[model samples]
Target: MTDFDLPEEFDEENIVSKTSIKRDMHKLQALGKRLTELKPNQLEKVPMSETLRKAIDESQRITQREATRRHMQYIGKLMRAEDAEAIQNAVDLFDASSKAFAQALHSLERWRDRLIEGGNETLSEYIHDNPNADIQHLRQLVRNAKKDLKNEKNTGASKKLFRYLRTIDDMDNETTP
Candidate 1:
């Protein structure tokens, strides 16, 4: 069997053309002009990886296959096993954390809605029966209930509870005298 040999395209020597000495000077002059024209923001752009720039620069003078192999080699050295493991752990934590938070928020909203509903129902019943009640007192209780109801839909419970609490408070004040 014949030995497995890579194609000439993958060989660096097959790709790089020796620059004529006179042309090399011209290339350097053009590179200098391009560098001077770069804006400050353009200069500040950070590379994804420092070696990426070197790999791209090398590609211009080498076979595409050789350039890719060199880039992969550079990247392999830059990545650490520990950092990869840590990133995986962080991603897992974010997923679990967000799910737990959403569930907790849903549970809390249900609890608040129940309280407001019950309060509304009781308050409404009390106000209906006590027509002669102090207008100021009744108004205060209703205003507070209105605010809560705005946050939640008005239901029997919220009306009843608000009226009930106010009626009880008013009765206690009247009895004290």
Candidate 2:
């Protein structure tokens, strides 16, 4: 057909440029890399599909550079089918710096210290507040933490105690809504 008789041009808004597509691919890859960097427990808190989780877990075992790169590309591919924003929000929850996160940490630390100092009294109080908590496990951690405090050594008991408290807090958060 002649130029004057040609059909109208396609809508520009509907077209995705190659540059934006590549940029998004790279962004997803970067997010996947962040996922791989997270600790196992932290990763568990993130909402992701089983297949994507398996790919990420497998990526950790890949030591060679080329293999890791290929696996990451696969992860980026998988990420395209997932809700990137939700995953990012879940991952962000594990990080520090925000006032809420700091407050939660301080609260857990206070509970740990109270359990160590007040012995059974504090244990009973905590159990009353967190009925769903593993009482026996928390009791054991408190005992170990107290022993560690007396010895003035960093044997990780205190850390374990803090972690246990945080776990209970996370559980409560999940159950409330």
- Measured by lDDT, the strongest candidate is 2
Candidate 1 has its poorest 10 consecutive residues by lDDT at: 85-94
Query: lDDT for every model?
Result: 0.44, 0.87
Index of the highest-TM-score prediction: 2
TM-score of each: 0.19, 0.58
> Whole-model lDDT, candidate 2?
0.87
Per-candidate Cα RMSD to the true structure, in Å, reads: 23.5, 6.9
Residues 1-177 of candidate 1: C-alpha lDDT, one tens digit per residue: 257876656776555455764364444333322322334333223222334334334434555876555544443344321243332332222233555445544543453344444565644554564555565665564565566667676545445544555445445434532
Tell me the deviation in Å of residue 124 in model 1. Answer: 19
Write out the backbone clash pairs for model 2. Answer: none
CA lDDT of 10 in candidate 1? Answer: 78
After superposition, which runs of candidate 1 have C-alpha atoms over 4 Å from their true positions? 1-97, 120-177
Name model 2 segments beyond 4 Å from true.
1-9, 97-168, 173-177
